[model samples]
Target chain A: MDNYNYASFPLDMDDAVFGAFRTQAPAAGDPAPDGPVTDLATGQRAPLSALWRSGPAVIEFGSYT
Target chain B: MEDLAARLGPRGFAFAFLYVREAHPGELAGHHATFAGKCDLARRLRDRWQIARPILVDDLDGPLHAAYGMLPNMTYIVGQGGRVLYRAMWTDAASIEWACDYLQREAQERRTSKRVAPFYSELRGFRAHDQYARIFMNGLLEGGGRRAADEFVAATEATEGRAAADRLRAARQELPEARP
Candidate 1:
């Protein structure tokens, strides 16, 4: 799914759709992909690598909606 | 999450909440149009949810989110050197705490015996679904506005959706805290 296109709310997240999204994702033992992220504390942009640089990171991806 | 951070942070685990695409976009919580807008929404989320963990806001269009599977509330425990240790479909604090503990034990074992190495495995992680679904929907509606409830009712049937709203209206503890 394109990141921009939300495909609307209450999506038909059936077993197949969930499987496609889950199976294609990065899995255990794979190198975590690094990208840009804005650290909320300083309100400054930073690389995703920064969060993990200090130690093992537990990242929970989400949003308000 | 705060308690987990307090207990495990000292043990060298850094916890974060990565802000991503809005799951249910509506008037109040629309699609991320700009980076600043997304950050503001993220800040509001952190404040409203009372999440103490550092909130990392993903860029608009969310390339990072797409690459990581784009699940709404997925949890990932990434170990040192950027190796993924555990990836669960949903964030379950208890299960995550157990994983952290397991990782700690694994590191100790590795110190004693050099045979320990990262390996691939999967499991069906569970979440407190029934009531939490209601809670999650309430959040979506809060941010997304009235249309959120309307679409939800249309999709899940007005009876089912109204039942949830009624329960929420007659609520006691909406956000249940789990303490160790």
Candidate 2:
């Protein structure tokens, strides 16, 4: 995906970009990727596992827009 | 999501919102040029929305978001072992709550009932959601300002709006004529 800067925000004609680039979601029981995430308050990078180490977690992903 | 967090938080369920690239970038919120800029937008989003759950911002390229499927407003349930328990293309609070409740009950059954053995299974294709125009428009406005919202409206008008209206008209035509 190209950099979605302000100028390039509406570059895609429709949702074609998503259709082409959307990744298949991890199925149930699959190991969730433990990628690094940035904490909003502290700006410190931490492992994604930190969120669910104690128990299960419901994580919602989206942008401000 | 806040309500879900509150309802299920005590039940050993955690919640967080992962901030990603703007879904509809425009002038106001625009695209995140830098990680710092993305964080700033995320902070503003938190303050503006008064989100209670912990906000975790993704990296600029969104490796995690892409890995988990790039659909906007997607949700996932990660268990203690970092295993995906549930995932949905769209975030529906009712569906999420149902999944959590079901999982918790299964856990309880495993602990208390020796007869029932837990096994992995996938339940899918149960889709119900509310898509109100006002809410969508609000998000567009927040992200890209008037231009984004306007463009979205125009696009919808060109595609879904006309197609849906045409389909509705055709369906009506198939119905028996009303008595005078």
Candidate 3:
């Protein structure tokens, strides 16, 4: 089991926002990865990386659509 | 989070999710950008989460958010003296539960020790949470809800003490564009 410490990460909205934008969304027509996914509440386009660091995330793709 | 809030009640701790700007507004690769509808998305999420606590809307001007330097999905526990005690961001559930238990203990100990001033002393952490909830609701209404805004106007008046009505006038002065 992973031990999560709030202080370890501290709170930096800047870094989190920056890192989210750096990740690439999956390409159109790409096969969906196997798992449950939840889309971001905003219907904005986002790379798979920005979807979430871990756990389920919402997504859109050509293959799925 | 709603379940946790319910369990903790007004005495344990209140949770509020501040909806800041979208990290990735239009696309994943873009730099910080703002979205028109993202705030609504946040509202929906709060509702879906069944969060009973308040979720305040941080405006485009970013006044409140700038004050807190808040990160997404972060939780802060403010003790009875208006002091922040526990803070967590990008957390795991198990750890958060443990921290919550610890917070409850701390609140209890503070109460038992009777170290706090009477006026500032809290019997349950929930009261503070409720207060924040009321404040946040007013803020949320101020964001766009007509009734919420009206209610907030009233609340501001009440809480502002002898200057309640005057504060409303000041608030009106603060937002000139809001005038007819």
Candidate 4:
């Protein structure tokens, strides 16, 4: 697998660049094991699906990035 | 540096070291880099650097850090009105010096504008030097999970002006709307 160079992409256009680069972004119907989700502030239990949201959030998508 | 903060003064700036979850707990307490025992290593680091600023420990459960959304290691510079002026993860001699310079410039601008400030007294040099270790290392606040809701309230008031206070009161007085 070819490594993507996200650093070279401009901040404003990075999302678009990623979409084209990845070619196949996750769809709504994927049945992969749910990712572990924790409320960063409280370290409390949260829905795994809650990770996908529209808002400002610090995402640490390690290795898969 | 002590010299920098002194030149910066009480009006100029204030520094708070929020001790959150330790990356290397063992390294902090002189055991080893591996995570192990809990000890106040911030004091030792501050003393070595001759820092005169107040360093507070985060709550054992890290509620304070959670409130700020702070990650493992970061330094935040909050302005006079409690507005976060700058934030950086980790600190080094050169990085801190540049930050100090930026903060000093900000202080000068605020002074010129004559803005309302949360005033604090000038910390004495003799006291800072003598008890630097104790002040920097020991827990400043008894407990960490204090509500910074007041800070948010102040910010809202500042942005929307005095008239918004009436709206805020009404909202708090009213009940939540029932879902259909």
Candidate 5:
């Protein structure tokens, strides 16, 4: 098991102000925050670091209302 | 996303959806006030949408969502080293597919490449769900929904332009009731 501290990750949510609407994505080579997220299929809590371990990952952030 | 996953999974590409707060909460699946409530709604959404990819639920406060632009629908591509390669404000399959292709080429070249410029394409006459749209549109015409719509429109106008914002508002008038 790997212990990861999310606080160390360079995550700046404030820069992503909703109405500002960034035309560009986060810059390449910028490290992504390995925050805690729940896997709905297995009902297990894991950091994003666990998900992108193998290779490239495509993540879609959304809600089903 | 599933289609992209299927096509790219064999090529060392992984796909997943990070379920955030409700986009349009109503009687069927109302807003989640607690972490547990959000988890329950996430399960329901996975089942309802028949989502094939793994669904990850964000915390009640939605730190992940806020970190990634806080949009209702956003797409991101992370490279091998947990670096964000591409991002889209809205979920557009075509643009995403193009990004994937670009990534594949970059991977083959075995070199760190420049970020692909963002592309926007407005799909005319695209409908998510007639039944759901009717309910959501009706909801948007009301109190909280109206405010959300206004805010979204203003945001769009500020970002994209008034024409784009007005088009989004016009979408409300086109919603049709579900077939009986």
Candidate 6:
């Protein structure tokens, strides 16, 4: 079987340009990226950084199905 | 994660779920080929799981998921200044609890010292919850039977390798029969 690159084909992480996997996440002291995300319930767009402005945030990424 | 969020959320810790692409797509709720379809699935997910925290959905193509290692379940703890304090490949309650404790203590110390803390990384063991595991296996069986299981196993094996797929199969075998 071929090496299935989920990061590229089905879902492009823009790894070649952004190097997302190099660090896996923002550094301890570095600022987190304010990426665009839509509120699932409300269908509104907002930067993720805005959510954690008040304090620390615990983010869990997953799906139901 | 929800339980921890409830416990720490009162203490100024924001907990949110980022809804990404489907892990085990089947005939019932298969993969989303469009953004609207993905959003609909997200709604169904929120209803099914009774997810209380704010849920942010990624784009249909999954830019966020890919940026976050494309894992089915990944947890990240971001501290003050929006810095990533911890990242777990798989969601482990014990490790997250430890992280919460560490962050709370650090926040307290920062009140007086105003010092920055270093990053902490550890290889914590993964503990699968029995009930949820059963639900997942049963869901696979109900969704499409052996074919669903096979597709799930294949997907897991592709991303996490054969060991993880084997573990899933073992768990599925232990599931009790469904009532008529």
Candidate that scores best on DockQ:
1
Give the candidates in order of DockQ, highest first. Answer: 1, 2, 6, 5, 3, 4
Docking class of 4: incorrect
What candidate 4 gets wrong by more than 4 Å, as runs, is: A1-65, B1-3, B27-51, B92-96, B103-180
Report DockQ per prediction, comma-separated: 0.62, 0.57, 0.02, 0.01, 0.32, 0.38
Native-referenced DockQ of model 2? 0.57
TM-score (second chain) of model 1: 0.80
lDDT of each: 0.76, 0.75, 0.38, 0.35, 0.66, 0.71
Minimal lDDT window, size 10, model 4 chain B = B139-148
User: Clashes per prediction?
Assistant: 0, 0, 8, 0, 0, 0
Fraction of the native A-B contacts that model 5 recovers: 0.62
Q: Residues B1-180, candidate 3: write the lDDT tens digits.
A: 555655655443544445554332212111122434545555555555554554444444443333333334444444433443443334344444565686566557776885643232211122234344345433333433434344445544544444754555455444533356
Model 2 regions more than 4 Å off: A4-23, B113-131, B154-180
Write model 4 residue lDDT over B33-146, tens digit each, in one string.
211112234445445555455444433444444444434444444433333343433333345556567556655786699674433322111122444323222211111101
lDDT string for model 2 (A1-65, tens) is: 56534344343444544454324568787899878999897878898889989989999997778
Candidate 3 CAPRI grade: incorrect
Residue pairs with backbone overlap in model 3: A25-A47, A25-A48, A38-A57, A38-A58, A39-A58, B10-B126, B11-B125, B11-B126
Error at A8, model 3, angstroms: 27
User: Best candidate, lDDT-wise?
Assistant: 1
Candidates 4 and 5 compared by lDDT, better number? 5
Candidate by candidate, in order, the iRMS in Å equals 2.8, 2.7, 20.7, 18.9, 8.3, 5.5
Can you tell me which runs of candidate 5 are displaced by over 4 Å? A1-17, A21-25, B111-180
Tens digits of per-residue lDDT, candidate 6, B1-180, equal 778788988988889999887766655666667788878878887787788999998877777676666676778877667777777767877888887898888778878888884754556466777676567778776643555566766766766678987888777877764322
By lDDT, the better pick of 3 and 4 is: 3
Query: Candidate 1 on A15-34: residue-level lDDT in tens?
Result: 43356666788898888989
The 10-residue segment with the lowest total lDDT in model 4 chain A: A56-65
Q: How far in Å is the alpha carbon of B48 misplaced in model 5?
A: 1.9
